[model samples]
Target: MPEGPEIRRAGDRISRALVDKEIVKSNFYYVRIKDREEIVKNKNIKEITTRGKAMLIRFKNGWTMYSHNQLYGRWTVNLNTTKIKSTRALRVVFKTKKHTVRLWSATDIDLLPTSEEHEHSFLKKIGPDVLNESCSYKLIEERLTSKTFHKKKASTLMLDQTVFAGLGNYLRSEILFDAKIHPDDRPFDLDKTRITQWAKSIKNISHLAYKTGGFTVSKYIADRNKENGEPRKSYRHAVFMRYQYECLNCKSRIERKWYGKRKLDFCPSCQIQTGKIKPSR
Candidate 1:
């Protein structure tokens, strides 16, 4: 699944390639979207943005094209000609004078009135975008500790898009690991300072992942990996997909268990359930 960062990065790349460029043509390989080509055809793309894991391509005529790369969806930008690998999987296409932006394997594509976009089903349920500069830690804390959510497991709440949009499976593990909070614990179990610290972790990890292209491990671990000649991709994560491997901090074997069909990894020694909770700086 392409999480928020990957989706946002794709939007950025598409915006760079197609923004302000007049759409000379629009193509839809998916049956549901076949009739919606008129929405973007012969119009200019004013902007491209991401809300949660969904992408929006705003046009000069006040119409917006919304697409979500759920699971297997991906977008590609090509110069002059299309760079589609599999024609059968192609879902949507936009052709400008210099570039062609193609979306493949994505099923959630729709046309929406720009003014009514906020009422869209998926967009309406999403919480604050973690990567947005305006994402508020206080708001996140309040939501996490709210009466409706305080009883839920921390892991579950983190994965809930309605609580913090754009957070995916791996990100949930990394965020909890960085905060030194056990996934099974409730947010109410922590002190106020700890809640604020957890919120900070969410923001910091989100920004760092976006800025560093999905690297979630701290600088020390990253530098150590480089010095040891380890591959960049091998150490990009802290506790994600590291089952049975040594912990980066405590040297203990990383543990994994299924959390509602999702494999969650953590350092048992580092993230103990009962202890004095310390604020993560």
Candidate 2:
């Protein structure tokens, strides 16, 4: 699944391609929403924005289209003359006179009132988006101290939409590694310095990944790895998929452990824990 930054970047692309442009033609291939295609046809797009992992496409009228690109869902935008060959099922398409914008393999789509876009179930429940300019340190710090989230395990809380909208597996691992905090630790277990690091890391890594196309390591490291002919996986992260590899900071092995259903990567020594963290593939 695409994280918040990825979704936000997609929104930026879609906005440039579709916003202010009239949807001269459109289609809704999903069985349930097929009839709703009429709603998007021939309308001027107002904006495209994202909340967490969901995308909202607003029309000039009082309506907005909501969609979430789960694991396989993708968006393609290009000149109508250009054809994108793909095996993914096409779910939605919006055509402006000069461009063809498509949403493929996505099913979580809905049309709702523009006035109530924020009230949409998925949008309503998610926490502040890291990429949103409104997400300030104070806002994140407040969440860190909130009772509803403070007690949750750091590993679990990182993926909770209500905790940090747009956070997901890979980003979770990178953020934890950057903060040097154990996933098993709750916010309540954090010292003031650790709490600050946690919050800052969330903002920094999310923004960095958004700017660098999902790579979490520093540009210097990434460029160095590239110059050295290292594969992307070797330099794109500090620890995310580098199991059995040396930690960038401490040189300890990057350990991979299963917590619930997701695998978390961390440096056993860099991220301190009193008890042994059971390792699994």
Q: Best by TM-score, which number?
A: 2
- For candidate 1, the C-alpha RMSD (Å) to the true structure equals 2.9
lDDT for each of the candidates?
Answer: 0.84, 0.86
Superposition-based RMSD of candidate 2 using all C-alpha atoms, in angstroms: 3.9
**lDDT of candidate 2 over 1-281, digit per residue (tens):** 88888898999998898888767888778876666767766688888888889998888877888999989889988999996889899988889889998999987888888999878888888889988889987788789879988888888989999888999999999999999888888888776788888899999999999998899998898787577666787678888877887787877888998987789999889888624545567
lDDT of 1 by residue, 1-281 (tens): 98899889999999998898778887767777667776666688899999889999898899898899898898988997544457548887788889888888888888878998999899999888988888889888888899989989987988899888899988888988888888888987878887888899898888788877888987888787567665665478888877776888889998986887998888888888845555589
- Pairs of residues clashing in candidate 2: none
Q: Looking at model 1, which ten-residue stretch has the lowest summed lDDT?
A: 80-89
Model 2 bad stretches (over 4 Å): 226-230, 274-281
